[model samples]
Target: MANTPSAKKAARKIERRTEVNRSRRSRVRTFLRKLEDALAAGDATQAQAAFQAAQPELMRAVTKGVIHKNTASRKVSRLAARVRKLSA
Candidate 1:
């Protein structure tokens, strides 16, 4: 329970930030899922395009503090490798 006015305001702020972070996380996941779906379908061109679209979103999530920098980079690297393998 937030008894103090300041505490109540902070709680409200936290609630709003939580919603925003959740939305950002969901958007990033959607981009990742699109890339995964394209990869699973075995379409190299589509996968490449999806990866292109997702790479920036992942990085953006990192910048927004929604995910870690190394985590985003690792995911991008792995996905790029898979896309390259698909093309080859």
Candidate 2:
């Protein structure tokens, strides 16, 4: 449906960006899942480590516009709270 040359080019660019964003989102999910698994397994040390790894990835996703900033912050806060509870 992109009749204009510029529109066609923009469509192509969107497709590429969509793929990249999808990949980034999936990677972020993987990190979150790792943290969840570690938490579920009741290993405080491992959970903490996973949380450490996931934090940056989540923030990066926010920076990249893959997810909302507040959503990322809420997730990080909740996970951190759970990690702290594990230690207590």
Candidate 3:
């Protein structure tokens, strides 16, 4: 129901942005899942590697505005703690 040309253009832009954001979010989730699986498997080395991989992806999502800074930091912190515990 976008009557104005500008409104239509804006709707299209939003659609494209939504798709990109969804893709980014999904990618981040996939990385997180990998980390989770590694953790659940109780393999310290694999969990550490997955944590190293996921930390950057989480920060990248934050920089891209797909996630909030504190949210990413908190996730990183919690996951890092779990990783450390596993290593210990």
Ranking by TM-score: 3, 1, 2
For model 2 the TM-score comes to 0.96
TM-score of each: 0.97, 0.96, 0.99
Each prediction's Cα lDDT score? 0.96, 0.97, 0.98
- Estimate candidate 2's alpha-carbon lDDT, on a 0 to 1 scale: 0.97
Clashes of each: 0, 0, 0
State which candidate, 1 or 3, has the greater lDDT: 3
Candidate 3: tens digits of C-alpha lDDT, residues 8-60: 99999999999999999999999999999999999999999999999999999
Give per-residue CA lDDT, model 2, range 1-88, as digits (tens): 9999999999999999999999999999999999999999999999999999999999999999999999999999999999999978
Q: Could you tell me how far off, in angstroms, the CA of residue 74 lies in candidate 1 after the best superposition? A: 0.8
Task: Give candidate 3's whole-model lDDT.
Answer: 0.98
Residue 67 local lDDT, model 3: 96
List, residue by residue over 1-88, the lDDT tens digit for candidate 1. Answer: 9999999999999999999999999999999999999999999999999999999999999999999999999999999999999999
Worst 10 residues of 2 by lDDT: 79-88
Q: How many angstroms is residue 86 displaced in model 3 relative to the true structure, after the best TM-score fit?
A: 0.3
- Candidate 2: which stretches are off by over 4 Å? none
Q: Can you tell me which runs of candidate 1 are displaced by over 4 Å? A: none
Q: Give the poorly placed runs of model 3, Cα more than 4 Å off.
A: none
- Looking at model 3, which ten-residue stretch has the lowest summed lDDT? 31-40
Q: After superposition, how far is residue 17 of candidate 3 from its true place, in Å?
A: 0.3
